[model samples]
Target chain A: MDALTGAWQWLTTAANWAGDKGVWHRLAEHVQISAVCLVLSCLIALPVALWLGHIGKGGALAVNLSNIGRAVPTFAVLVLLTLGPLGSQGEWPTVIALVLFAIPPLLTNAYLGIREADRDAVEAARGMGMSGPQLLLRVELPLAYPLLMTGLRSAAVQIVATATLAAMAGGGGLGRVITAGFGNYDTAQVVAGAVLVAALALAVEGVMVAVDRLCDPMRGRRRAARIGRGPGERRGARDDDAVAIGGAA
Target chain B: MSVPWSLTAAAWPSGQVPADPGGPWLPQAAAPGGADCLVANDWICGAYLRTRSHELLAATVQHLGITAASVALGLLIAFPLALLARRRRAVAGAVLGLTTVLYTIPSLAMFALLTPVFGVSVAVVITGLVLYSLTILVRNILAGLDAVPAEVREAARGMGYGPARMLFGVELPLALPAVVAGIRIATVSTVAMTTIGSVVGFGGLGNLIASGLQGFFKAEVLTASVLCVLLAVAADLLLMAVQRMLTPWTRPRAGSRSGGRRTRATKAVA
Candidate 1:
């Protein structure tokens, strides 16, 4: 209880929110790093995954490879790059490390999403003499939108969480607050930093959830379908969606 | 790279100290104009492994111990939670929602939040990991239970099987594959997250990697990382094998679709 109050006091301090090393600066650094990594990961991963998922060949191998990537600890990759020649380059090691960490989820989820898009719709589009890109954009992409969003949300959240390691590598982030607090043995500051990070992560999740609902092309159809279903089945379907989001993260 | 002549002459009473023997592929450990001992900074040093074998072993053991305990505990807790959710529609949303929210908490922050209560102990790591595992385990277990064929339950009821007997004998056996799939994912991820425990001073290979990063000790970071990856791969393979052995009926034969469907279902969940 005392520690909680101390953390609150630390968070409330005006002096702590100013200057280069202030809470706002660290939060900006954290968000900036996470955004850069997320964009890089999506750029590198989404096209390949979507193309491969479209062709329906080699996606298995690609997905399996990324699964292996998941087992490679992000911290290990970050430290290895930092200790290697990349160490000489400022923030390059951190950027490269985080991009690598963010790619697997994006790749796996995007590929799976595209591959699992409605086959009947694809057939219907093809029968109507639609071009390949037309079939993909008009038929497949819309169907896959929900899953694609889920992947993006998970990847974004993960990058935000893992960006904290940047502080360990002498880069800037909210993690620096916790590390600095540890340096000074200021438990209050440490707790405050943790609270800030947790809140940021949850806020990110909530925003994505809203975006997912807003952007889904199937929203009306899904809601109508839900209304048609019995209450018990409706709840089961909802649970599965929540579980998928959690699993992706 | 050969040792410089001046330093060699001064250090060795003999005219020259021999430079490191040239290997076609390997870099010289004892590079001149820098740290004298290769083990102190080299990327891959045999000497460091020979000297610190005990320490490496201890860290690896601690890592394995923590991962195993956390996943085991997670499964134990998830089983009941899954059952409770399955019991009613009202309870289902809350259970799944809570676990998902818990799953979103970042590891560094999770530890920091936990430390106030657990005080930098192994308990903090274990508790956090168990919470993390709940999302996967509960979902998979519930999925498995739901997938059990309605006809099978009816047949068991016709034979006078009670709820307890049907769950253990009929439903659980059928659910084993999905349950095991969940375990595999949870265990592999736990192995990776276990390194984060180093922040609290209980991270197994994480401890070595953390310390190594601070001083830029390449061999320690590289070796510990390799071991951590190998451990995750090994755990995944072991669980897959257990799934195979326990659910022989689902095994893929020449024309069997059951195994293929199971694999797809598991992938869909992940």
Candidate 2:
């Protein structure tokens, strides 16, 4: 309880929120780094994942290869980069490391999203004289939207949490706050930093979920008879669950 | 040219702790002989092989111990929750929701949160790692239970098996593959997460990387990180082998190749 109170005090203290090293400054740095990594990872991963999912060739192999990304520790990558060629290049090393870390879930979820689209609906769209691009942009992409958002949310949260490694590597982020706390043996500061990170993650999750809910027209169907869900939402929450398990890890 | 981190770390002023140096807070500085051999770039691999072989090997064992113990503890917690969720539909929602929320809590934050209560020890590390393993385990466990064909349960009942006996004798074996997959992901992930435990002083191979970073010992950092990746792959493969051994029936007998491999693979994760 004292620890909680102390953490609250540390968080509320105006002095801690001022200056170049303030909590708000650290939070901005954290968000900026995370945004850079998230955009890069999506650009590199999503198109390939979506295309592969569209053509439906080499998918298992592609997913398997991507799984290797999850196995390698991102922190190790940061350390190696910092200790090696990019040691003095500032935040590039951290950015590269985090982009790699964010790739697996983004790629996996996007691929799974498109691939899991209702084959019947896709076939129906094709039969309706829809062209290839039309089928994808019109039919498949909307179906894949919620899942893509979920994947994005998961990746965002992870990158935000991990961008703290930037601080350890002499870059900037909220992790700097905690690591700084550790160096000073300031438990209250460490707890406050953690609270900040946790709150940020949950906030990201909540916003993504809201976006997903709003975009997904199938939201109110659960009570509308199982039949409504069958044709509309193909394996809704369950697909997200599998993504969370397989990709988020 | 890429100068080793030591030069930069040494150049930093002492008062700036973050920039001053980087490494494990708990582990002592490397021995003089070990540090000397690793001072140059070319001799790094040799230094690791000669001096760090034992330390790296010991850290690997400790890493495996911590991961295995955490996963096992995860299983103990997940089973009852899964069982409860299976019996009561209402409880499943709450239980799964709680575990899912717990899963999203990042490892570093988790360590910091638990530090106030548990401090920097194996207890804190394992506890956080176990929470990570829960959603995977519980979901897979439920999915496994849900998958036992309805007719199979009917047949078990016909054979005079009670619900408990039916679960133990009939359902569990069939559920083994999914359960094992959950365990594999959990264990492999825990190995990676254990590296973060170093921040709080309980890191296994992570300590090597940490201390190596502070000392600018390339061999130490590279070896430890490689060992971590290797450990993850090895743990994953080992579980694959165990799954193969346990589910001998899954292997294709002759020419039924198409669905056999893919279904099992998907089912494990699905």
Tell me how far the alpha carbon of residue A208 in candidate 2 is from the true structure, in angstroms, after superposition.
Answer: 1.0
List runs of model 1 lying over 4 Å from the truth: A225-249, B1-40, B259-270
Per-residue alpha-carbon lDDT of model 2 for A61-130, expressed as tens digits? Answer: 6567545866777667778888988888878888888887787777777887888887998999999999
Estimate candidate 2's alpha-carbon lDDT, on a 0 to 1 scale. 0.74
Candidate 1 residue B146 C-alpha distance from true site, Å: 0.7
Chain B TM-score against the true chain B, candidate 1: 0.81
lDDT of each residue in B1-270, candidate 1, tens digit only:
122322322232211112333333445443453344453577877666655665677678878888998999999999999999999968888998898888887877787888788775788888989999998899889989988767667777777878998888878887888899889888888898888877767778887888888767788889999999999999999999888887766776665676665553333223
User: Per-residue lDDT of A54-168 in model 1, one digit per residue for the tens?
Assistant: 8887776666755676577777777788888988898788889777767776777777777877687789889999998887788888877766777788777778777886676
Alpha-carbon deviation at B125 in model 1, angstroms:
0.9
Docking class of 2: medium
Could you give the CAPRI-style class of model 1? medium
Candidate 2 Cα misplacement greater than 4 A, ranges: A217-226, A229-234, A245-249, B1-37, B42-44, B255-270
DockQ of each: 0.52, 0.53
